[model samples]
Target: MAEFFDNYGALLAQGTIDTLVMTIASCIFAYVIGLPLGIWFAVTAPGGLKPNTAVNTVLGWIINIGRSIPFIILLVAIIPFTRLVVGTSLGVPGAVVPLTVAAAPFVARIVEQSLAEVDKDLIEAAHSFGSSNAQIVVKVLLKESLPSLVRGAAITFVNLFGYSAMAGTVGAGGLGDIAIRYGYQRFQGDVMLAAVILCVVLVQVFQSLGDWLARSIDKR
Candidate 1:
């Protein structure tokens, strides 16, 4: 173990940083796209305040299609697009594009579910105050759904963490790549074990933070 640490510890540490970078950057970008898209889906669906079937239907299909595509397939399928955007499809930068694309729809679904859980009474109360659609969505729905949203964010982050590792399979730098190249390919079980432990640790830390924040902020 000491020898392993001496030789590969630094590499694993760098891989962890790269993985966090890819995971976090992808999450920010995914949420930027997903949040509004989710709101649109929620407010345009049947019985939604704005109830527009055409808009809802189209958005649903698009989101569903995006969610249906497997992440590994997505990682490969968008190689050209990823390269076009990042000018390469290997390493952390290359991984970000695909991770972002892969996560957006999943994030959207999470957001949709979070919003769906908000009590209708709260929305009705907002409407009673003559709140505009935007006001209700922003103030009531999002605010009330804060805990659930935070939890959803945790789930999304964890899910994306896995995707980032898979991205490592194609030379996307991270613990995944290290584990793949050294642990699996090179038959370095210690390296693989270390990489897996690091990933689990990262996920647990993130999830605990998210859950704590959600609980702290929750009023109800």
Candidate 2:
């Protein structure tokens, strides 16, 4: 074990960093696109704040189709678009394109669920106060649903972390890539074990932080 660490410690360290970068980048991108999309989804649903069934239905279908595609297939299938967006289909930046695309639908779904969980009474009160639809969503629904949204974000982040690892199969340059290249391809069990341990540690740290944030935000 000591010998193994001595041999591939640097590589594992690099892989860990790559994995972190990919996960963080993807999470940010996913939220940037997904949050508004989710808000739109909620507001446009039948009898919602804005209630545009046609727009809601179309957007819902798009989100569903995107979500239905398996990540691996999505990764491979989107290669052309990925390259068009990032000019390459490998490494951290290249990986971000597919990661964000894959993550957005999942994040949107979570956001929609969180927003839906906001009390109907609160929305009604905001409306009674002559609040605009946008104002109510921004001030009431979002503020009230923040804790749940944070929890949902935590779940989405962890899911993206797993996807980032899977992206390594396409040379995305993360711990997953390291595991595949050195662990599986080169038959290095130590390297694979190290990568797996690193991933587990990352997930634990995120989970702990997320729980802390959720608890801190809980006024009740």
* Model 1: CA > 4 A from native: none
Give the best candidate by lDDT. 1
Candidate 2 lDDT at 58 equals 92
lDDT of each: 0.90, 0.88
Mind giving the per-residue lDDT tens digits that candidate 1 earns over 89-176? 8888888998999889988888988898888888898999999999999998898998999999999999999888887756878988
Question: Which portions of model 2 miss their true places by more than 4 Å?
Answer: none
Worst 10 residues of 1 by lDDT: 164-173
Lowest lDDT sum, 10 consecutive residues, model 2, at 165-174
Q: How accurate is candidate 1 locally (lDDT)?
A: 0.90
Q: In angstroms, how far off is 110's CA in candidate 2?
A: 0.7
Candidate 1, residue 12: lDDT:
92
What is the lDDT, from 0 to 100, of the residue 67 in candidate 2? 95
